[model samples]
Target: MIIKKIIIRADASIQVGTGHVMRCLALAQAWQDKGGEVIFILANKSTALENRLLSEGIKVVYLLAETGSYEDANQTVDFAQKFNAQWIVVDGYHFRAKYQKAIKDFGIRLLVFDDYGHAEHYYADLVLNQNIVVNNKDLYRNRETYTQLLLGTQYALLRREFWQWQNWQREINPITRKLLVTFGGSDPDNVTLKVIQALDWLNKDDLETIVVIGGTNPHHEVLQKEVSNSSLAISLQRNVSNMPELMAWADLAIAAGGSTNWELAFMGLPSLVITVADNQKAIATELDTQGIVIHIGWYQQITLEKIGMVVQEFIYDQSKREEMSQKGKKLVNGYGARHVTSKMANMLS
Candidate 1:
């Protein structure tokens, strides 16, 4: 086992979304599989997210201080010491150099989950950037000599539910009909409703769509009403646990370009990615440049009518769909959490 105890510091909310927490959950699950214990130190109260963690047999602790603030790190350290945690992992943009150094000041080993090299400097024993396109790795060149970077999709931490489907083969049909639309755990801008409206414009009598909403989506009532009234065949799924199964069921996905992108890739589901966050634009563009998915530009900059036109064109592009599916499956092999956990064990040794 890898020191037996680990603590993760992350938060989920409308502003921050749930990617950090979900990815950390993947790490926590991997640790659990190795007979290790996991605890979460969060700055916000997301009841559904918290309940999901508890049901997985992991413990969660909410911090009273502001997220990523100096005091936030202080509270996290107190819990790390209380549990005698072997290592502390921090994820999210709010966790910066000060937060990392504070955790390390206690002599506890630290691992940091990074995206786009947001931190100016790092003191963590290990730093992981799981995105396929990370243009800012040079930013970490000035860090401590002991700091190690684990980059690329090879370290993509997928949830435990996806582990079983790692080896499952996808058989692409000649014609695409089924669709999956998910805009991450929190669609604060209600982009999902727009996507649904676009799907309605497709007006393909044979088309089917599943629109997934996160637990924190404040516009659920509005979205549900739209779904109930839509002429297109559509269903709304909330806080679903069978994401991998859903991915397998769909021929293609119209999704928000976030952590879920990796899941779609692992399942060999070709996607049209619409980015909601500012930083997500670069990642989406890179995925497009790499031929992994078709980037539909920033959410606000894209119109629903334009989105419908893109979907209509993509539906009949059989050759392109197959190419993207194969390329995606090759990029993410679904052993990321396994590789990361093994590295942690090696670090302790």
Candidate 2:
């Protein structure tokens, strides 16, 4: 059977961050590639994010109601009925059991993208947890018996652009000099500034820095000012299109522990990870344990001296950097999106 129409329910903003919407975009891209139509339902929208979806030829339906509210769910159901969507994909921690059950009660097939199983109960036809360290059975013990679990990094939803770099090789330099810093889309706590400040303290004349920020970041002006005034050679990249190229070019990175961790792993870029949110703790810890990245403690606990020290260590240690590069590549093969799309297509058929 052909999966003709798909409705994706996700949101992007300063508070919620853009990971949910971006990952859903990856799935939507795969669906569209297979001749399927996709529509997005969002409550809190950013103009730049909406423009991105429009550029990809996908339709967007704005939801004025609060996220995960009864009214929001009703609006989602209304749109699902209007489009006759074959499947409804719900992402974000805001979406809970009630929201999932409401869509399922409307007689539509539901696929939920989850992190840490924040839902009190699960009613979707499929529940997907794309984290590397989650125990599916333990996290979703209360889920409906009919619900199928798609767990772990095997189903990691990456964007279409990264797919093209699957066979691309990275030239790991013996002495790491170039660095990339990205602290997710929102960075509400302004961790990026702290990182830049740390780099400034390092004061390495030979270091080259590339800083990437999202459109919704409230600290953009502050960051630009910081970069301009700092002695370090920092290049500020906002809402960049060539992330894969930047990842390829960087010898090392300082990043927040989020979905971008998977992208960095796929590219074999060794990184120093800082946990900016509670949900990120497990990911950072696991990556650190696996020797894929140096998981520095939480953002609040991490000081500039600590960041500078770690940077210096990574820069001078060629063997450890090479080890991290190899381990990260082994963890993520960069084909998770295609694998997930194939699974969804098979399920629809």
Candidate 3:
């Protein structure tokens, strides 16, 4: 089945961070690869998504204000109606059932993308999440409302580049040298600063640290200022596109608790997790229980002492490190994006 007109509604900003728009971009790329026509209905209030979408040459119908309300659906529905959009996809966490139902009468098939299982999603025709603990009946409430449930990491929204890297199992002590730190696209809480400061105590000259910051990050200037005169050979990367390649090269990841958590798991990259956002706490807890990551709690709660101890534990315990990596890799493979795209395609037809 050919997808002709697909309109995606998602947002990103200093407040919402980069995950929402990034995932939507990944999905849009996948759809475009299959010869589908895609446009975006984006919020105008945030320059983040608008800038990125424009850079990608994707057509965007901007909603003038940033009110994340059910009323926004009316504007999108009107826009979709004019364009004759066949499918409308939404990914924002703030988007509720009422907002989705508002567009249902527009004759566009509704697909809701989410990872947080906090609320009931009764309006969607299809729901997607790559997390392990999602309970469809509980989350959707209207389980019999004909909504297709796409669950598990097999549906993770990862870009194609993560699969292109060529790597072989080389013999390097798993506990040595390389360190990767990524705190989502926009580290709004300055978790990057806290994490990097914690790493200061571990100031090993031999350790190679790579920090990936988002383009819309408000702390980007502050972080650059802090790292400018640093003696450490730290590679500070902004708006990175080659994440999977970077992940493949690293032995460990020190990251915020979010979608990247699953991305790391896909590469078998064990991590030390810090929950920067409230929505991330559940997955952090689950991964922590599985021994894939050592949870250092929320960003504000985590201390230099806690980070130092976890870093030391991962460094000294070789077998434990390997165990975590193996378990994490087993948790997620690279098929997630394909699975979700195929499902959405089938549904569209």
Number of clashing residue pairs in every model?
Answer: 0, 0, 1
lDDT (Cα, tens digit) per residue for candidate 1, span 1-349: 2348999998899978999999999999998988899999888899999999999999999899988888998888899889988889999898888888888888888999988888889999999999877655685885788998898899999999999997899888878889999999998999999999888876876888999989999999999999999988899999999999999999989999879999999999999999999878878999999999999889899988889998888888989999999999998999999899889977877
By how many angstroms RMSD does model 1 differ from the true structure?
1.2
Superior by lDDT: candidate 2 or candidate 3? 2
Name the candidate that leads on lDDT.
1
lDDT ranking from best to worst? 1, 2, 3
> Which whole-number lDDT from 0 to 100 does residue 216 have in model 1?
93
- lDDT string, candidate 2, 32-147, tens digits: 88888999998875898999999999999899788898888888989988998888899988789999888888888899998887999999888888788975488899888889
RMSD to the hidden true structure, all candidates: 1.2, 1.2, 2.3
The order by descending TM-score is 1, 2, 3
lDDT of 2: 0.88
Question: Over 4 Å off in model 2, which ranges?
Answer: 1-3
TM-score of each: 0.98, 0.97, 0.91
Off by over 4 Å in 1: 1-3
CA lDDT scores, all candidates in order: 0.90, 0.88, 0.76
| Alpha-carbon deviation at 16 in model 1, angstroms | 0.9
Give the per-residue Cα lDDT of candidate 2 at 141: 90
**Candidate 3 Cα outliers beyond 4 Å, as residue runs:** 1-3, 45-51, 54-57, 118-121, 165-174
